[model samples]
Target: MKYTRILTVGALMASLAACSAGPAGKAELCESFDQLGTQLLSGNGIGNPLFRAADSLGDVAERYSAQNLGSDAKSLHAIADSDGTDSNELRNATMNIAKICGHPLGLG
Candidate 1:
């Protein structure tokens, strides 16, 4: 019973710590999403940086949707997945992401 109590207390403390380390703030999340979008849009081809941008956008998309940019985030992912051979798609997606993030990177 004592060990069980100690375990429960430890679990509670861990959960509290996790709760304190919450998600990034709205401005930060939006800026990160915009930055990744810019990188993907500027990429010359489907390379490491492009793939990294896509991967990062996956996380950004989740946070963006939480902040009510669900349609833009989904569109961003779709463009990322489909724009391997066409920068125009990426450019359009970047514009949408920038508009949603309110931090345009001047892709147009």
Candidate 2:
């Protein structure tokens, strides 16, 4: 089911990309990415929040992947791309992202 969701998101993003064909489309995509991140951070409850976070993470990843930002997807892709996975930078970045999104991961 998780895999399916990922595929679906990827497909959806691709379709969106096709429809949006200029600077305006890029701005809209970027806004959607930011909004999704915000939604992830604002999740309430305990376990439910984690699940929502996971889902939002996936969606954000898809958006970032669509952006084709390479290793510079900022805080979120730092860990995934393993550019700072072994250092405190990754942890700090992760925490900052969570905090910026209005969710504190408390892993720092």
Candidate 3:
């Protein structure tokens, strides 16, 4: 029984570690930004419900090792979280991260 508990605890810790291991590389971060861009750059942009869920993106950004990446993500997420966030600001924030990730996202 004690061994079982230890194994379970070990498994949980491993899962947590894996979850915390942010993007594998710049490519991964760019992919994440791409998803956000799709939702944000849409006609609805901030009006969309998915835009509200963008706050979790910062958690991933924070886990990234790059210097400006996290801050850029923070700016995007911060603007996203703001009550009066505008589409232009959102576009700019997304562009900043996209530029850093080398995957510039253009709006449709």
Candidate 4:
């Protein structure tokens, strides 16, 4: 009986871990967006590259949302593609998504 109880508890813990294992939540997405925006605002140039990279991140976030990966697609995309100057911010944000979603980008 004790062994059975232990096994059940172990199973429950495993299930909970599995449930919690994937993706950033909406709050995290919002925070990342804000950080990216701040970076963009502090940089220079036309800002088109930043926006383009952000758009790509937004696309991935939307796909994740469709798969129920814990982000709000509309909100994340809106925040991500918002105005900014820092190219790194956009790149980092997209890279973060790629890391989380297990999608790697290759530069040709």
**For candidate 1, what's the RMSD?**
6.0
Clashes of each: 0, 0, 0, 3
Candidate 3, residue 73: the lDDT equals: 69
lDDT of candidate 3 over 1-108, digit per residue (tens): 999999999999999989768554565666666676676556444455545535545555666566556666677677656666555666666665666666655432
TM-score of each model, paired residue for residue: 0.49, 0.27, 0.60, 0.31
The C-alpha local distance difference test score for the whole of candidate 4 amounts to: 0.49
Give stretches of model 3 more than 4 Å off.
Answer: 1-14, 43-49, 106-108
Computed on alpha carbons, the lDDT of every model, listed in order, comes to 0.59, 0.43, 0.62, 0.49
Best candidate, TM-score-wise? Answer: 3
Higher-scoring candidate on TM-score, 3 or 4: 3
Model 2 stretches astray by more than 4 angstroms: 1-13, 16-72, 83-88, 106-108
- In the predicted model 4, the residue pairs found to clash are 40-84, 40-85, 40-86
Q: lDDT of model 1 at residue 31? A: 61
For candidate 2, write residues 1-108 as lDDT tens digits.
999999999999999977643333334434434553454445444544433333334344344423443222355443444422322443344443443344444321
In model 1, which runs have C-alpha deviations exceeding 4 angstroms? Answer: 1-24, 41-47, 83-85, 94-96, 106-108
Q: What would you estimate as the lDDT of candidate 3?
A: 0.62
Q: Write the per-residue lDDT of candidate 4 for residues 1-108, one digit (tens) a residue.
A: 999999999999999977755564555544444544554555434645445545544644554432443343444355445754244434443555545434332220
Q: TM-score of the candidate numbered 2? A: 0.27
lDDT: which candidate is best?
3
Candidate 2 lDDT (Cα, 0 to 1):
0.43
